[model samples]
Target: MKRSFENPLIGDKVYFTKYATEPGSPASIIDVELKPGGGNGLHYHKTFAEHFECLEGELSIQVGKEILRLLPGETATAPAGSLHRFFNASAQPNRFRVTIDPGHPGFENTLKIAYGLASDGHVNKAGMPKKLWHMGTIILLSDTNLPGFFSLIQRPLAWMARRAMADGRFKRELEPYTR
Candidate 1:
């Protein structure tokens, strides 16, 4: 696996610095850098929690209904099943460390796929996949759930993803990024 991943479309860079190799350590840890005005949409994970610790600049994270602005040395946690998002609203870049407890391999692969898609111009300007099946595949693998009414379509999206997997399309797309 690559040590670093970059989403040029969204101005986000993530460096995988730690993994669940130790007996008693973080499942996954990453150093993240978000360019000014760069951020991700609100979404929730079905498993694991993300502990965001700001390292430089300002990191704004919205966890559930509250928006927390963290500075250097501050930390905020987005527990599993909580709708959350993060961004860099500052004029300069924002650097933070995200620790995922009980790490998930699918989630890690999701980032690689998404970033690869962006680099290949398979995603839109907003960094979303251009194809529905691709979107479904990503959502299925990432454990990411959309908010509100969009959540209702999770089943259908998952179905599409499963179909792709069954047809070997998923393997074709994922193999380049993962294994």
Candidate 2:
């Protein structure tokens, strides 16, 4: 297995073991270890489904209006366009595997850029970039969207971010990951 990437939102490490673009693979697999009180807030993907398999410890997953607490060897699925989120509500660390169907465009690079930005102290307390341009750039690059009302502005926001990036204002932040 390859080394993991540090994702502040999920945990200290997230291993991208398999990519969706790999020949014969239909999805991307990610192994994550979530520390106590760490987890992703409500979010959803519009184009790809997501499945989670608990590997160790406990994981709390919210799919739509339902909350599923998964134990070791248990699993759950959230279809595309479903509102979902995951977190470790226990005191102990939790480990799980996530599979994203059809893969997300620039998924790996987006993770790297987010983590790298956090490492550089460029993100806010929620692990999101402090600058709107940076945030928009990530959203556009990864094809990730916030649920509900926030989704309404994603298109225009992405357009502005893309314009900034092209003009060199946000290019520096994406340098390491893009190269």
Candidate 3:
């Protein structure tokens, strides 16, 4: 199935427009656009390393406490297990392509969780619902190893993804593609 990640952070700044599904191996191409200072907070993927190629503007990449500045036409890799974050540091806009290997099934949902927490403006009780939902969604989407619960786990995700994409809420959430 095809899906788009509606980021709850910048309100549709970036979009995970296409997803490719192969039986065993996982991979995806993401089109990313970041305005000055726009980026996700610090985080790491447990099993996915995203190789990024800049299509426009400059990007500031932060990996494990070190900052690297990347210009247009440059490429960088954020390996799995590394704490990394990136942002558009230039005055103008920036665009890039992120090719993630061994696709991460839980990446999109994790953004929503982080956005929800940020929405409350503090990591406190108000954001608990979002945090819980984030965790729950991940379990449902990724815990296919559980016995007899595969269908139950996947059904809600399918429904939610469809609804979000159709409503334009998905686009509003991602806010990742704006110049």
Candidate 4:
């Protein structure tokens, strides 16, 4: 098991961070502060649910068909496969944290890839590309954790994740990892 600072959004006044606990557990914590009109683009997790808690200002979270406005000390949860998005509608960046259940391998590695792409000047302020989608399938097929048929699916699955990350719908905040 490895632990370190990886997520791009970590700092005192700008953004927060995400951390993975233990190994093989599907969970992560994301801390963030969104500036006025700043928010996370719409996305969904097919593997685990995401819960959020507002630490400062007001947070506007959209879970499926319902949009919720959570104030300080408030919290909300979005179940797996639910379309969810969050933002700050105030003058200051809204501060909050997200916990994603059911972790995955190279969680930090994925962020590094996205950040590397962004640093090359390919990403927008929102961090999302023009398009992006599910790339988890790629990891599953090529993990090498299992042999036989599972290994056979690696190439195709990785191809799909690459394509989705290149042109998926939601953009993730990314940064190179450092300890």
Candidate 5:
């Protein structure tokens, strides 16, 4: 099955073409179309590796301290625990395919939640949650970490977020994705 979502927060169109739910399959296959100057913040995954292959336009990827400009057919991998981010630094759109290792069900759910929230206008202009509690829930669910100074408070915020979720405040909002 093919699922697609447009995330205004990150200025990207994402398509989920395949999901790895069986043994020995790729975690997930995603096609992304990034608008010019669009990208996500520097973050790291604790348990999964991400691989990116540029399908069209210029894809600028930062892995650790190295910046790579990938063209069509070029690829890069960000191992687990490595700080990385990707963007379209050029004047046009950047299309790319991303593969995640050790398919994570929570990751897919997080994407659906984010996109759904954005569609409902619950996120800011930058495509981030408008509420602090929502942000925390996302962090906990996605298992993504923000590097640099934000790292200091990530844990505490996530803790509070988890508490809020457990209290059932997010139950209604999370229903679509969770179920």
Candidate 6:
């Protein structure tokens, strides 16, 4: 099964072609379209690595302080625990295939929540959640680790996230996104 999600605020789209739950699929794969000058900020994951293969246009993957520039068919990887991000500096949209090694359904769900938040104007200019609790919930559910000083608040946010999950806030907020 394939599902497409869009972040209207950033003009980004992710088409989920394969997920862990799918038969014979070992990883979560997405065909992503990124708007010019748009992409995510630096973040790292502890559980999974990400592979990016440029399918069209130019793609730049930044791992640590090094940037790997790619043309069509080129690929780069950010291993687990590496701080990284991807961006499109061109004037047009760029398409790339991203595979999350070892697959993470929670990560996929976080994408859904993000897009839903953007559609509802609940995200900031950079497409991050405007609400601290919401951001914390996403951080917990998605296994996303923010860098540097931002990491300090992770614990408090996680605490709020646990409460949200137990109080049904998680399900209520995710319900709109899943459909």
Clashing pairs in 1: none
Per-residue lDDT, model 3, residue 121, is: 49
71-158 in candidate 3: lDDT tens per residue?
8789888887676778887788888888778665455544444444456442344332343333344434322222234435546665
Instruction: Evaluate model 5: give its lDDT.
Output: 0.85
Q: Provide TM-scores for the models.
A: 0.93, 0.87, 0.57, 0.59, 0.92, 0.94
Provide the clash count, candidate 1: 0
**Model 2 weakest 10-residue run by lDDT:** 1-10
Q: List candidate 5 stretches off by more than 4 Å.
A: 22-26
Least accurate stretch of 10 residues (summed lDDT) in model 6? 170-179
Shift of residue 12 alpha carbon in model 5, Å: 1.3
For candidate 3, the 10 contiguous residues with the lowest summed lDDT are 139-148
Global Cα lDDT for candidate 3: 0.58
Q: Taking the tens digit of each residue's C-alpha lDDT, what string does model 2 give over 24-96? A: 6778888988898888768777788889999999999999889999999999999988889999989999999
TM-score of 3: 0.57
Q: Which is better, 1 or 4, measured by lDDT?
A: 1
| Backbone clash count, each prediction separately | 0, 0, 14, 15, 1, 0
What are the lDDT figures for the candidates, one per model?
Answer: 0.86, 0.81, 0.58, 0.56, 0.85, 0.88
Model 6, global lDDT = 0.88
lDDT of 5 at 114: 84
Q: In model 2, which regions exceed 4 Å deviation?
A: 1-3, 8-11, 168-171
Better of 2 and 5 by TM-score: 5
User: lDDT of candidate 4 vs native?
Assistant: 0.56
lDDT of 6 at 18: 93
TM-score of 1: 0.93
Ranking by TM-score: 6, 1, 5, 2, 4, 3
Measured with C-alpha atoms, the lDDT of residue 150 in candidate 2 is 87
